[model samples]
Target chain A: MKPGTGPLLRVAGVVPGLWLAGFFLLPLAFVWILSFGEKQGLVAVDIVWTADNYLRALDPLYLGILAKSLWIAALTTVICLATGLPVALGIVFAPPRWRPLLLLLVILPFWTNLLIRTYALIAVLRTRGHVNATLGWASELFGLPFEPLSLLYTNTAVVAGLVYVHLPFMVLPLYATLHRLDRSLVEAAADLGAGHLRVCITIILPLAVPGIVSGSLLVFVPALGSYLTPDLLGGPDSQMIANVIERQFKSANDWPFGSALSFLLMYVTFGALALRSLSVRRPAAR
Target chain B: MTEAVRVGGICKRFGAVTALAEVSLRIEAGEFFALLGPSGCGKSTLLRIMAGLEHPDQGSVFIDGIDVGRTPANRRPVNMVFQSYALFPHMSVRSNVAYGLRVTGTGRAEAHERAEAALGLVRLTGYGERMPHQLSGGESQRVALARALVKRPRVLLLDEPLSALDARLRDEMRLELVTLQKTVGITFIIVTHDQEEALSMADRVAVMETGRIRQVAPPAELYEAPADRFVATFIGQVNLFPATIGADGTAQAHPFPGVTARARGIGAGRQVWIAVRPEKITMAPRGGVPAGRLSGVVEEVVYRGDLSVYLVRCMAGPDGLVRVSRANAARTADRLPGPGTEVVLDWAEDCAVVLAS
Candidate 1:
């Protein structure tokens, strides 16, 4: 309402903010508009609105696929937490000169293409891969029967691949948080007569919760939407929502269904993130 | 009441740099001892060793007559108030103070009782639920002290606990800490680089230098009868002059041509240093007693309200500078000693200490 007030606020903060609104909010609004429209043979009338697409998307078969995707993503996240915490701790406690080297080692795999890394796991877990060959050699040396194990295309392999590809994403943040934790808190716990494990549980773990939660979030949502690892290392039963969306858009030639599936995936990811945001209580910044 | 702590022949080294060298001391049950030193002087290192945070490369440590050399920090009978307080940011003030009790298997009700008592001791009774970040620096420091004292350590160690506070708060906390020690009757070992802090709060001060104890004595004894040149200069502002010992133990100190004094165990022509406190020296008018008198030029005069300090430079032999502070009641606007004014300095022979250089 005032002459110079709006421009002053613009110079202070409002300008860069409106620029983001123009880019991100405008595109999201376009997608929301497209999501509610009806398409018939890819030439539907824009005015004809229907809730049928949403209802059909809730069909048991599609919901079952969504559930499977969520379950696998949750499992992948839990596995990352179990393995990433110690690795993060090790980096945090490392000597000052060695910390940078250890962090670099954890992130070395990320420098290459993610697809390439997942495929590398494919080479190692095949029926006649390095693991089987090593087992065969060991059995022959011990004068026992040798057999090539079947681990190439399975859910276990897919989960393993997901963890490997997303591990640095999980570890880097946890390491940053753990490294910044006040070491005196741990010493104080020990002085209070807490044993080693008690110190870790009460002091180290709680302080590191933010990092753990953030690492889980960074890994979980992407793992849920992942199609590459599963498609390469999984069977038909292991196909995730992203694989289904890919199939609908490229192979099925059903534009309306594909658009509906895309919107549904976005909605589910948004809802999960919203729930996560509500659950993890943030510490007040200094 | 306990015997408190005994540290015997503790030595520590970080690679080639020896941080603490064979330091030994005993703390009484209820005395407040201070390790006073400049930065890099290993006072904090010794305190950390006593707290079990650092392992002595050689020697043993005991608390309440129990050998705790191989014991972990959690098993020791000592607690420390870190310089930064190190209070858990996620926990409230009450929880932070109760943390040690809770982890040691105390029940919630009992832990809360002790925590409340400790908080009350530090005068923070109603602030239990406030987070550490919400408290002021002084309040947080008090909370840290309460946290350590709540555990009832046989000996409480504080590493520059008041170094983080502003000057006014530091003075207030000094008084509070001394009173708290008396009230609790627990042994307190505080490490500080502040000479005034050491003099004002400690029962006995151990002055450290270059990873070793220079002298350990009462604050008055340490300042009045320093054992060496380092202790004399470090404790307070002093004027030192190079002198030589003569036969019959009478040493002719320079700048005072005929001034001689007794020096023990010194051969003739051996170099020695004479120490004189600024307040101990006096400037007199013309026709003053001529014996034990030194001649110097008044370099500068600075008025500090309560007293005025005159920096005088001796022109002959070993050019030493002496500071003389005159009381404000003796202020004079007439013929004040300006720069380059010839003046005579006189002091009793007992006021000056002669030491081997």
Candidate 2:
């Protein structure tokens, strides 16, 4: 006879479930309660319930940071998808022996620390860096005078950094999905008079939506809350919402306001993911 | 009638393995043909070559007298039903059936109308809105058939179409497929490993082994006059006895001391094998051995509901069992002889076929 799932599952789930409730849910509940309180002196909280923190977070100055963050994250996601989709497809369709090596190359960057990798990008992008030095040498060899271009410390550099870091997040899911696609379905479509473009549009693209949704969520959520890349690479005008939140907690000593801002980001991210999952589920149900 | 598909001197190799070796065959415009072989025998490869899914390394394929060796699969006049059915999981039944028409730029209304007609022909008219995953295995196969037939292709290729279904559904679909083919009146080519499917459904079958065609014949001729030892044994169960031909045009083999059967196409003193089907041999009571009969002892009896199979140990043969099958026509207590009983077996002289390979 089989063991009953009731008591056995409850016994097995006790440790991890209690661990999550204690360390994760308890802190989140405290943060929610703290968002409504007032901040007193440094590291002190006063129990005066008010809506002032949320009101201040809705100001045009803070809202603009949020919008800018969304724009940058959206752009980064688009660029990653445009580049990652082809790379993922290539890996899935590559010769059997070369596939593992190519996948390893995609993941090799993760072995290094992300902060260290971003700092290394500065050497390639700075004026008189590797790129400018190469361009200057090529111009001089051609007997043409050239000036070193300022490639770092700009919005472009920030976007490039975000895209570089998030590209693998987009590629891995797409590879998993495309690899699971049946090759016979493509052959059947071709046998039914669909050319290569039609096969991609009608079959491959629609079937790959789950992967695209997952990859977009993976890239977008982290990008929206990112602070390091913008601070290290962007100009003062390119500040995002996360930079503001960081300043509120560390420099301004405003714990309640920072908590309120964090909740807002969480709510918006949750709403977007919920909407995406709903859209994905409807077609599958039909 | 003009040939619908003609493959000439085709050869295909996959790295180190040769899939097809200078293979060639012609299919008529409306005939049901089958390529029958075991796994790795290159029947599927030849079917793919005809569908333009795989290209031959040498020679050419002509559909309706137009050389299609350079044509891509989408542009070819042939379509295939894959082994897995390959239905689009996301699409509705209507959309799946209409996919071919829509891809070729047919108008939306026309494509839908033709798709509905195709569905009705397959008796799944009310299942248009259902997803592919909602259908059973047999329904999925019919939808695949409807999808291919909507294109009205010059030739239809089925790669093990019914291999995935249960036994009852496979038998039903076999008849349905034959009726569908006749109603549509287009050429159909199927690849299968089941000898029974090939013999029962195809108007003609090409038996293949090691990338070469052993024989191509109708069902009756293929069973009655196999070309060599492979076709003789591959088509059905046969009892083979190693023997030699005498100068008097007679075969001398074990269990039959005197020269009993005559064979053609062999010189005297040449080695050969005589083949006879199990059902062709008649079993009688003990001590009933006639002048040309062989005697044996029944070692095992397998009683199927419809027939009884007896494994007999031949007293004079080279230490092998000769099987005999008898139909259970009447329900009687002692209709079949029990095991360990002595029996005499004899077959008509013309029933034995001599193979010299």
Chain A TM-score for each of the predictions: 0.87, 0.92
lDDT of 2 by residue, B1-357 (tens): 889999889899999999999888999999999999999999999999988889899979999999998999999998898899999998999999999999999999999999999999899998999899999999999999999999999999999999999999999999999999999998999999999999999999999999898999998899988988999989998888888888997888855573256887689898888888889988887774564367778999999988898999876445568889988887983867999898888888788888888
Which runs in model 2 stand beyond 4 Å of their true positions?
A1-23, A130-149, B258-260, B316-319
Instruction: Assess each model's interface with DockQ, reporting 2 decimals per model.
Output: 0.65, 0.80
Report the lDDT tens digits of candidate 1 across residue range A175-223. 9899889888887777777898998888899888878888999899999
Query: C-alpha displacement of B193 in model 1, angstroms?
Result: 0.3
The iRMS of the candidates, in order, is 1.1, 0.6
For all predictions, the C-alpha RMSD in Å is: 4.0, 2.7
- Local error of candidate 2 at A154, Å? 2.4
With a 3 Å backbone cut-off (N, CA, C), the pairs that clash in candidate 1 are none
How accurate locally, in lDDT, is each candidate?
Answer: 0.85, 0.90
What is the clash count for each candidate, in the order shown?
Answer: 0, 0
Candidate 1 has an lDDT of 0.85
**Model 1 CA lDDT for position B326:** 70
Query: Highest DockQ among the candidates is held by which one?
Result: 2
Residue pairs in collision within model 2 = none
The local lDDT score (0 to 100) that residue A132 gets in candidate 2 is: 92
Runs in model 1 lying further than 4 Å from the true structure: A1-49, A132-149, A276-282, B1-3, B258-260, B288-292, B316-318, B330-342
